[model samples]
Target: MVYQETVAAIKQLVRDGVVPGVNYAFIDQKDVTRGLFGAEQLIPGYEPLKPNQLYDVASLTKVVGTTNVILQLITEKRLALTDKVSDFLPEWQDQRVTIRHLLTHTSGITGYIPHRDKLSAAQLHDALLTMHVGENFEVKMVYSDVNFIFLGWIAEAILGQPIQTLIQKRVLDPLRMTHSTFQPEDPTRCVPTEVSPTRGLIRGVVHDPKAFVLKNHCGSAGLFSTLDDLIRFEQAMLFNTGQPIATHWLTELTRDQTPLGKQWRSLAWALLPTQLPVAHNCIWHSGYTGTFLVLDQTTQQGMVFLSNRVHPHAPNEAFLARRNAIINTYLAEKTVSSKTE
Candidate 1:
């Protein structure tokens, strides 16, 4: 019944036209519950959404896929958070940027650029390497995709393999996250994103133009996954099975590294310090295509909310208020019960 209220809230939002379709799951350690609501396809035909449907997961890839690869590399002693960007890419040799700056989004790199149409793959790489950094690049956590994109390049350079392969070997395979991948082998099973004029009904392929132009294998974006796979991943972060990454490193990943903001981010995560008496800490990240994951490591509880919110139309902003409301409601209940006991 705890999850049912959240499910009903989602259904009400879908009915109110806030989002087209949503597939969400809540995991409290071993206990798990999920729900699917609304139409997965509302344009050409009406198709009911399914629990196993794949979502673009937009920028969520930065954390769930890309960040995990970087963490694994660090755990293996193959990379260091303090390693300079120029060390791996010679073009960046002049800039004093480090892996930590990239991970924390303080590299002074721009958030996004129209590189897909403006530059070739090689040219794009060069542009990213030569892009301007803030005068105080080491301090500001600007939250940019350029940081993760460059990190993806480093993963390939260090592993002598493509980023997708590195992710499969180091993350997906190790965690048994078989349902998640950079490119979904079965396109039909994927929930379609926005019907862009250039890309049409985006399905299976990445929704991010830069990642799509880069052949759907970038670190910043370009991942597809279901709620269940992400639930498993949350468990990995909480339990630290020690298969994909070390427990010490896992704890480090969530530790605040930047003092730039009131709610500073961790290595690749956005920390949400709650004033709620029930839960004191909540770290989360979201994607452009209407997906987000949140965890309360203190309680070993988390949830993944996946939706095709961009379908049929592109919004100026996401329903972040609704997202916060859901988390707040979910955690408040747990907190109240614990206090009552």
Candidate 2:
């Protein structure tokens, strides 16, 4: 009965066919509650959603994988927020862009690569390095996958290992997130995302086009995780388990790091706005594959919602609106509960 409103909203989404199903978890310092609702696959065969199913987890990779690796490096003093992109990647021509800009999404590196999905991995890498800054650089918050793509490269450059490997060793292993992985070995264990024209049903592989092109080499996306693993990951962050990253750096990761403070963004997570004058103590991020994670530092609570909203087809504006409503309902309920306690 806890999170009753949120549970109703999720069930409504399933009934409306907004998403095939959702696997979600609510976790705090001591306890976790998880639920699986609906089917994982609707076309090939009717399959009930089950625990331990891996989700593509699209942009959540930025925070769950790439951002954590960057944070660990920074904590070890191997990297700095002030370090320029040009410092690590010699091909990056934008001297004005810093690690801080990329983490906070203020880099303004907004060049559009024509037929970007068609580009080869090496070609995509080349195009990203040549991207120039936008006019709003550092003045506006434009969330771009390009920022984390570059961060992944920078982390690799500093560590001399692939981004996936870095993420595995630095984050997944440390957090004991056994169910989280880049490319799942068994397709059956993975939840399908979109029915891509070129790739058929996007199952075990990543759903993001650029990430698919770059494979595990690119870090903007391409992570496969489960609700249980994500709960562990969130608990580690919310409770400061202090294995993958230090407590000081975790504090920095959750705090707003926007240069001008015009738009609130933590190191890699977005700070959710509340009605209160002060911002909410929650840092959250969403994946394009209908997955999202929210962690409330002050309350030591976290929520992970994973759904394949894009499965069989892409989502519409209505799906997005309803998804936001579901999240907001959870936040509102939490807020009310906090006041009563």
Candidate 3:
């Protein structure tokens, strides 16, 4: 199969020091193709990557975890897109930020805040509220972790529970995503990320500094998951017409909400680059730890590629180019097959 060949390419890439390891799965709505290649750890010792191993999926938490929870709350009438930040937390009442703005990353909130060292997880929400809203707040889309940071807090405030609990009860449990979670119970089954100067050889624990400081569960980042669980998530997202989330809302969530050329963003999903094969109807997102997800609503197809590209140290710029090349390879094959049929 083409996926096998692509998986081989990934294996070769790992062998050639392009990355430490890769655990990938692709869903075409009918069946799944998954593979694990290279050593999960290569510094102190060599350990084979396993099919069920979890990875710190970093910012993917925005879509697969946080977005799922927000969508469910919206569906249940517990939250509205128009709900203002001031409504949930009193400090930001005049900020004029909405739930929709946060999801779409159009709130002009700073992309990141360096408060992890100073504030405890419990204090992040208030600290976030006090952060300066950019001058052009809500005027243009700027991808921001702060956006989902607040959303996580808003969900907690409304549900009267922690974000992790809500994710477990509402999102992961129902989908039977047994291995997907914020704080993984088993550290051994997860692939190691960066060997940070401060943290040393990181494994199982989240790689995002902000999330690590937030007790291993945060809105913007901090989720560990396997390819199987992620495939289940892609299936639900593509075929949720009558499932846990309503069809209408799912459609709205994936469809472009931002103005054209303004960094196309759906409710939470970013529009696929039109230059990519079959991406016109696609939405995708990636994690900071070299993980990526792409779904084509037109064909009910999706791909998840997870990697520990920053094993010994953080990457400077090449990881994204490598990621896109692999994704484009898969999509290119799919495109060719489509034309012949």
Considering every candidate listed, which one attains the maximal lDDT?
Answer: 2
TM-score against native, each model: 0.92, 0.96, 0.91
Kindly list the per-residue Cα lDDT of model 2 for residues 20-68, writing each as its tens digit.
9999888745778888899998866778998879999999999888988
Error of 1 at 43 (Å): 1.2
Better of 2 and 3 by lDDT: 2
Ranking by TM-score: 2, 1, 3
Task: Flag clash pairs in model 2.
Answer: none
Runs with alpha carbons beyond 4 Å of true place in candidate 2: 274-279
- Give the top-scoring candidate (TM-score): 2
Candidate 1 error regions (>4 Å): 111-118, 259-263, 275-280, 316-318
Across 40-95, the per-residue lDDT of candidate 1 in tens digits comes to 98876777897788888889878877888898788789999888888888777555
Per lDDT, what order, best first? 2, 3, 1
**What's the lDDT for all of these models?**
0.77, 0.85, 0.78
- Which 10 successive residues of model 2 have the least lDDT summed? 273-282
Candidate 1: worst-modelled 10 consecutive residues by lDDT: 109-118
